[model samples]
Target: MTELLDATDSQTAMLADLVDSVRAVEETIARLSAVRDGMLAIASRIAVDVARQASHPDQGDMAVRSVAAEIGAAVRASDRTIERRMDAASWLVEAFPAVWAAQGAGRISAAHAQVIADAGAHLDHALHREAYAARAVEAASVESPNRLRRIARRIAEQFQPRTVTERHRDARELRRVWVKDLDDGMAELGMLGPAVLVHGMHDRLTRMARTITLENAQATKASTEETGEPDTRTTDQLRADLLADLVLTGSPVGHDSQTGVLGKIHARVEITVPVLTLMDDDPGASGSPPAELDGRFPIDTDTARLLAGGVTGWERVLTHPITGALLAVDRYRPSDQLSRHLRARDQRCRFPGCGIAARKCDVDHTHAASHGGETCADNLAHLCRRHHMLKHHSPWHVRHRRVGDDRGEHENDDTNAGRAGDLIWTSPTGTTYIDRPPQQNAVTFTEDNPP
Candidate 1:
C-alpha cells in the first residue's frame, strides 16, 4: 500500500509540473508572436516606403508584392499569406498600439489581439481608435478569442460615429452570392447579405430539413424491419438536399406538390434585444448599439424592431443587467424550451475552436444515454455533427466536469465562465482540453451613443 501511494504521489507531481511547463510554453509562444508581428510590421513599412520612392506609379503595387514574395520564400510560406500578414501586422502595431502592447506583454493571445485589430480597423480617427483599443484589449485579456470577437465588435460600434443602420444600408448595396470551385468535383456556394435575412434563410432551411428528417425516419423504420436497410442520411445531408431542391425546383423534394409557383416556407430565429434599445424612440439614431443576431453577431436595431413587429410569436428573455446571465425566458414554444436554452447558452459548437453556430449543431448527450446518462442540461451540449460523431466513433471522450474538479478550476475565468456546463474532452493520446462555454456577452445599453 505504501509503495502504491508513493507511485501515485510521484505521478501527481509530474503531471503538475507538466501543466506548469505548458503554461510557460504558451506564454513564450505569445511573446514570440508579438516579436514576429513587430518584424512583419517593419517589413511592410520598408516595402511600402521603397515602392513609394520608385519613379513609376503603376509599379508600386508590384514592388510591394515582390518584397512580400521574397520574404515568403525565406519563411516557407505563400506570398499572398505573407502579404496579408504584413498588412495585418502594420495595422496592429500602428493603429491599435494598446492591443499590440497587450499581445507583446503576453497578457492576451495573438488571436485575441488580431480580432481586436480587425474589429477596430474602421475607426479612422487615431483618438477614437485608441479609445476603442483601450477597452477592447482589457476585455481581450480575460475573454476567450471567440467571445472577444463579439465584445470587440460591440466596442468598435460604440466608437464609430455612424449608426449601424447607416452602415447596414451602405453595406446592403454590396450584397452578393458566389460559388467557389473545390476539389473532388464539388463546389461551395456562399452569400453575403443583411444578418437577419441570412440567418432567416438558414432557419427556414433547417425547419424544412426537420420535416424531411421526421418523414424519412418513419419510412426508414418500416423499410428496415422488412428489407434490412435504413436511410443513413444525416441532418446535415438533409439540409443540403433541401437547399439544392429549393433552389432548383422552388420547393423541397417531396414538398413539390404545392399549388403555387413556389411552396410556402417560413423561418424562425432567436433574436435577443436590449429592452431599452427596442423601446427607444429613435432606434436608428447614431450611437445606439446594435441588436444581437442569434447571439453570434450584431445586427441593426431597425431590423430587430421590424422582425419583432412582423413575427407572430417571440420569446421574451430577461438577462441580468450586469453579469449578462440569462435570468428567464417566457415560453413561446414550450416543447422546445430546453433546446432554445441550449442554443442561447452554447452559441457555437461546444467543440474546442469550432465556430459553427449552435442552431445548426446536434444537441448531443455528453454521456451516452444508452449507458444511463440522464437527459438534462448538465448531460447535454450542442456539438456540430462532425464533432458529435468524433466523440462517439473515435477514441475521443468527453464529459462535464464536476464543480470541484481540479481541471475545472484551471479553465474558469470571468470572461469564459460557464463552468457548470463546460466540457472536458480527452483525446486518444490521453491529453485533455477543456472547452468552456462562450461568455454570454449580451448587447446591453451603453451611455455612449453614436454621433
Candidate 2:
C-alpha cells in the first residue's frame, strides 16, 4: 500500500511526473519482453541442436518433444504453445536474423516476430525473405501486430504467387464455422472464408445492427412519450438478437410491412475478380486466385461467382495495380462521393494509431469547409465520432500535403492526379508527425502479370 501510494508521489512531484513514470514503465516492459522472446528463440535453437545429437534412432524427435514438454510443464503452458515457440525459434534462427536482432533490441515483440515467421512460412527459402524481413521489421517497430500481419501477408503474397490454387484448395478443404465457451460462461463464434465475403458479411451485420438499433431507439422514444417508459435493452443485446434473427429467419427482428422497410439490408462488398475468372474461364489454366475481399481477403473464384449471381448490382472500385492506389468508384450519390473516396482511400480512421474502420467514420475536412476548405479527396480523411469531435473541439490540428517528385511541398495537383497525400499532425504538446494513407503495398502476382 505504501509503495503503491508512493507511486503517485503526492507528497512531492505533480501528476504529470507520475504519468511520465507510467509511460516509461510501458517502454521498459516492451523492451524486456522483446528481449525475452529473442532469448527463448535462442534457447529453442539450442534445444533443436542438442536433440540432433541423439544416440538412438528415434532420440532426435524424442529430445525435441521432451524439451518442449519440460518447458511447458515448468511454465504452466500448453504443449501446443511450447511446440509452436520451438518452431518459431528455428524459423527465427535460420532465416530471420534481422528480425531476431530486432526482437533482442526491443524493436518488436515475440508476437510480432511470430507474425513475421507465419507470414513467410508458406513460401520457399530465400524467396524475397530479406526484403520481407526488412519491410516487416520496419512496420513492426511502429505498427500494431494486426497491421504488421496485413503488411507481412502482402509481402508474402508477392513471393507465393504459385501457391494460389493450392491455398484456395486448402481453404476450401478446411472451411469451418464453430462456437466455443469462454471462462466467463459466455460463448464465442468464429468463421473463415474468402476475405471479401467475410468482410462483406461483417459490413452487412454492422449496418443491420445499426438499423435495428436506431429503429428500436425511435420506438422507445415514442413509447416513452406516450407511456413514460424507457428502453433498457443495450445496443449489444439488440445487435445479438438481430444477428440471431437473421441467421434463423433470414430477416431481422422489429421488421413489419407497415414500417415501409426495404425488406433487405444494403452491404457494400468490394471485390477484385479477374475478368477471366468471371467468364466460362479455362479450368486448365488455374483461375486467378480467389477474388480479393476489399483488396485484402481472398474469396475463392467459385464463391465470387456465387455472390455475383445472387446480387442484382454490386459497386465496383478500381485501383492502380502497380501502386495499389485507389482510383475511382461508380458514384451514384453526388453527396456521398467525398465520403466514399475517403473510405476507399483511408479504409480506417486517419488518427495516429487508431484502427476504427473507415466505413463507420465521419469524413472530416482537415481544413474546415466553412473556412474555404475545398471538398476534395486530398483535403478529407476519416475520423470516428470521438476523434472527429476531438479535432474540432480540442487543440489538435491536421494539415494535408501532397509530396511531389521533388519531395517538397507542392500543390494538391499531384494527389488530384491519383497520387497519395501526406497528413501532418501537430499535437497540443507542440510535437509534429506525418501520417500516410493506409493502402496495400503493390502486390505483383506473376501468374496474372507475367513479365
**What TM-score would candidate 1 get against the native?**
0.48
Q: What is the C-alpha RMSD of each candidate to the true structure, in Å?
A: 26.5, 27.4
Model 1, 20-138: lDDT tens digits are: 99978877788899999999888877767876786536545555555564565445455567778888988899998888888888888889988998898778899999999999988
How many clashing residue pairs appear in each of the predictions shown?
A: 2, 1
Indicate which candidate wins on lDDT: 1
Give the runs in model 2 whose Cα sits over 4 Å from its true position: 1-63, 142-150, 163-166, 171-183, 196-451
Model 1 residue 150 lDDT score: 97
Judging by TM-score against the true structure, name the best candidate: 1
Error of 1 at 344 (Å): 51
If scored against the real structure, what TM-score would every candidate get? Answer: 0.48, 0.39
